[model samples]
Target chain A: MSMRDRLRTMGLGAFGLLLVIVSWEVIGRNQLLGRTFPALSDVLATIVDPARRGLFQRALEATIGSALRGFVFGSIIGFAMAALGVIFPPLRAGLDRLAAVMHAVPLIALGPFLIVTLSREGTPTAIATLAVVFNVFVATSAGLRVGNPLHHDVLTVLGAGSWERFRRLELPGALPFIADGLKLAAPAAVIGAILGEWFGAPRGIGIVIVSSLQNYQIDLLWSAALLGAMLSLVAFGAFSVLERWVVGRFR
Target chain B: MLSPGAELSSESDKSADGSTDPSIEHDDISISTSPVLPHVDASEIGPANLSLSGVTKRFPLGRNDTVLALDDISLDIAPGEFVALLGPSGCGKSTVLRLLCGLEEPTGGDVRIRGCHPSELVADHRLGVAFQDHALLPWATVADNVALPFKVAGQPVDNDRVRSLLELVGIAEFAKARPKQLSGGMRQRVSIARALALRPEVLLLDEPFGALDAVTRRRMNLELQDIWSTDQITTVLVTHSVEEAVFLADRVVVMTGRPGRIQTIRTPGFERPRSPELLRSPEFHELVDELTIALDEEPA
Candidate 1:
């Protein structure tokens, strides 16, 4: 399809979102949900008023900083673990069992334990980062193992060394899958950051959101949630653009 | 057609005639020998072009048994000659090409190229190969694909040479295009250009045109013959088509099915610089008929 056609399709989705927002505003203003749901206009006004006055800036900065740090640390650990697992059979089996157990453990359950054990300062963001790392590690390693047989044969005939084959073929072949995993993990990272703030944090969108809810300032709470959603969407969009750039270069 | 002894004596006489005029005498000796050695010269340059001594290839089957792909085969291909390995599907014709190209090792015996082993030449970047599938990297443009050998060998690419080779194969216009955008015939042409990029002394082709339509195949065969004649590179082609073998090859080496062996080495009687019209000639039909009968004789 042409570029213009693709843009138009995306534009239609935006238009549908506008309709949902208008409906939500009309229903909430009429007290359809008895003040539980805030009017969309009130949420927008709260966002604009504080954002214009820069009151939410520090909270926004704190949330973004913690999320970025957690994402970076988690991704690095995940990659290292995956490489170790792939290189050693015993390690792979051990990691497989460990990963299964880890996956089964609820993120919420681990939050308090991690706060007590890892942080004297009680930084719950660490727990969220750990959750994201394990998920990404599994996805990337599985993708790497799915190399094409025909492409492998071609490399073999060329007498390519193991490292050369991986660099030239396997890595590029696994990129699409790795991108999928990263996309899935991105929102999880943001959520983990927010969850950590929810349990215990001096500042962040999650803290503001909780306070707003406790005070019955439903519009402010909704605005904070909206900001978090936008943050996740932005991260996903950035990775999507990266995927396109990489695939385009190869093609 | 003369006896093998006469052909042998003629080669010896041609050597005595003059070492400077080796090319002409070689063609004469080949044509004079039973119409089986079309234009091949058995004269030595420095070493034999390709030699397989009692080569055997086997694949491990399930538990205790093994399937013999090639069995105790001995063959020689001189430099600057066109040889076609014609056979049925399971005949291991491609196996022979792979062995010659150093893509696979023999289970027993030896494979030598220009008096050195296939492995030795492969390391030195002297081997060039083309397969039935035209394994061009989809990501690379036509020009980049043709320059792969140079890149892999750490040699600087000669842009002029790449262009010339592309022109030789008649795909110069598609240099900037991706493999996915090109037609099947055009892609094969790009592959041929890539194979010739290194100017390899020995070219190994495993049914390079098997995927093409009959008309395209015939056209490619003529183009290949012209290239072979002009370049004088030793070419070993594996093909199932009898007409292709008879049309382009100086010597057609027919192989039998399971545990493939050389059934016969027939020299086609057609003249040099073969054209499409030669396909309709009586002599061409006779050669095809002979090969067809030989193929039919193998037990089902």
Candidate 2:
């Protein structure tokens, strides 16, 4: 693509983001929804408040750390399962159905049950892992199947064993797809971690948001929400960069 | 007859169970475009005899329905013989190649290579095949794609062999380039080079030039002739082009459409190292016309 085309795309994206922010400020400044939704300035003020700096810092670190841990664990497990299913095809249907059933269970219902079994502290990471698993698994499985039939035949007649076929053909072919999954799963994992934190986690942005809402500190609540959104967006952006690189190399 | 220079034709078409490789030990090729193309010592690579006796292939179409792709098709390819299976679309010419390559199991009869199962020959890394798609890995360079068979066979990549094959196919300079970077014809050359990397005994080609334009396809056909002359390995090519079959093969086996049966087999008496001069000769056109008519003839 030309430099001008790239710049235009970037310009459009910035414009879209600016429009959303302007709309939010307009609505919040007008006391939209009876002051429950605070103005962007009020939230920014709370974010910049020196007194609350330690509390927000601790909350951001905890949420981000757990979310990243969950993301890595979930992506690895999901990728491994997909590879296993491809290698031993008889297990494919069973694993696919299992993934579907797990995904079908509501997060809210799973939260209480996970809290009882693994306790509130572990629940956040567990839920985050679970949330990322489905997307990663689905993407990887589809990617593995997306290999060209002619490539398969070439490898087959070349006397490539199953392992060789996976190494040379399926794995490389699936890289772009798996990278895309990781990009999408990043935000999901952050969302899951935050939601899991709500089920009585000791400290996190989720905790701050819940307590601030109870105390009617609308600015603090909005600030915590902003922090979670920022973390999710950052994670998404990082993975998107990775996805582009993988596609460049593999596709 | 194998080549003009190496006129080694065994009396019996079928190769004995165990024999030395049947490659034509040609001294040189006249394609001056390439400088000193490396010699292939395919002498160690025994050209395996291929036999498909009363082979029938039927694919399950669901609801207890089956489509008969090949019906009682019997063919025998001598060691170092280049045979082409020509037919209309859906005539199962490609399927025949697939069966010969052990990509598909014959629903009936036996398919053998050198008195063993096709799978057995393949397991020993003795089968080479090029398909219509030029299935080069998008991620790999031309040289890497051509060197794949060595990797598949669990052997270290023979850079020298890969380079020589690339030279043989006239794509030595494009070795560093990826499949997407090359033209359609160039990618097919890489595919063909990959197929030949292992010095496979039997070369199976299913319309390797089918996707190229007319000029490119004809040129590729000529290049293939040059490559084949060096090592006249037992080859079976499946193509719809009558002229291509006549130009390349010692014998052209034409087939009828659907439930494909051998319509007629004709010996295209062309001297090899087939020159471009022969393509314009009356003999080549006459045989091509004969096969074209045979291909169009309805099954009785």
Candidate 3:
């Protein structure tokens, strides 16, 4: 496309963003939920207050660090398990059945048991990691299974060995699907980490929200919620950038 | 008549005296009298260049009966000869290519290349194949797609060789472009370059240009002839178009339907390094007509 067309597309996207912000500001100012719904300005005030008082520097670090650690651990285990499943049919079949059973079990219900079994030492990191693992595991396994049959035949006719075929054809073919799964799992991972914190944790956005609720500190609760949303958006944006880089290389 | 064990040099001299070089002419005299001897000497040299003896392929039909895809098929493709297998859709034309390439095994007979089974020599990079579909990986660039055969065979990339082949196929400028970015004929050219990457002794092409339009197909046909003449690799092309079979092959083996068997082989009496103008001549039409009649007479 021409440069003028590209500029018009970008301009339209910015206009859409402005429309969303205007709607949110108008609704919040009119007290749509009868004072329970915080105004956009009130939430912005709370976010800036912590930074003004200089308390946000430490809290931001603690929340982000725990979430990042959980995401890394969960993704590593998920990918290893997916590779194992592809290599071993029996293991893949077993995992498929297990996933079906686990998916039905609510993630929220597992919180109390995970705290007792894994977080007995009061480490919130372990529980958060556990929550993210299930989501990543399912996504990765599904992605690996989506390799195309025509591409497989191309490898076969080229006389590629089984392992070589997996590396060259199957792995690259599965990448787009795997990247899509990871993008989706990013936000889920953050939600999982924060949820794990809600049951029991020394520090996290979830703990702050709960404490603020107990004291009826509405502004603080809104601030914690906004920070959690920001963390989710950041993780999502990071994966989006990585996905573009990978897809770009292939193209 | 030349026996299976006879040397080709003596037989070739005998055949050349009575008729023009079989490579340039298609005639019934050529078909009936041309030596049926194996291409390469198996005893002194390696295996027969490419041999399929009593090869039969059958698929299970659930009941007691089996569907014979290929039956008692035997042929030898000599190095640097361009042979075309001309048959209708269900004659297992493509199946023969797969069997020779070792993508599928023959149920009843042997597939030998240079004295070894195809499976045994695959690692040596002796076999190359092109399918009906271009089969270029959409994500890979033209150069990368063409380099795949070498990569899979664990050979180092010969960038100069790849560039030359791209130039031969007239697509050197599109090396950095992805397959999706190129036109259909361009993609198939990339596939052809990839098949030649290993300098394979035997090249198998299954209707490689059948999907293209008439104009594109004719252009590709001319390009293929030029490449084949220069490269001198043994080529076996499976095609349904009679014109394609007549234009490209030293011998067009017309196969019967169903339990696919070689019914007749026709030799077109045309001079090679064939030009595009040769395709419009009366001789080409006569050759195409003869194959068409043979095909129509075959049992469905």
Top lDDT: which candidate number? 2
The residue-level lDDT of candidate 3 at A242 comes to 83
lDDT of each: 0.75, 0.84, 0.75
In terms of TM-score, the best-performing candidate is: 2
What are the chain A TM-scores for all the models, listed individually?
0.88, 0.97, 0.85
Better of 1 and 3 by TM-score: 3
Model 3 C-alpha lDDT per residue in residues B1-300, reported as the tens digit of each score: 233224234433433453534433333223122232445443332212566778899988998988999988877655456779998899998888888878788999988877687776576666777888888887788998999988898889889988998998999999999998888899889989888887766778989998899999999999988766655566899999999989988767788768888777666657876888888898788878888998898565
Model 2, runs deviating above 4 Å: B1-44
Could you tell me which residue pairs clash in candidate 3?
Answer: B25-B268, B25-B269, B26-B267, B26-B268, B26-B269, B27-B267, B47-B114, B47-B115
The CAPRI category of model 3 is acceptable
- Candidate 3 wrong stretches, greater than 4 Å: A1-32, A51-55, A88-90, A120-143, A248-251, B1-48, B60-66
Rank order (by TM-score, best first): 2, 3, 1
Question: Between the candidate structures 1 and 3, which one is better when assessed by DockQ?
Answer: 3
> Model 2, range B156-204, lDDT digits (tens) per residue?
9999999999998899999999899999999999999998888777899
True contacts kept of each: 0.11, 0.87, 0.53
Question: On residues A66-181, what C-alpha lDDT tens digit does candidate 3 reach at each position?
Answer: 67787788777777777678867679888777767766777778778877787722344555565566667777777667766656777777788778877787677667656766
Tell me which of candidates 1 and 2 scores higher on lDDT: 2
What are the candidates' individual DockQ scores? 0.26, 0.86, 0.48
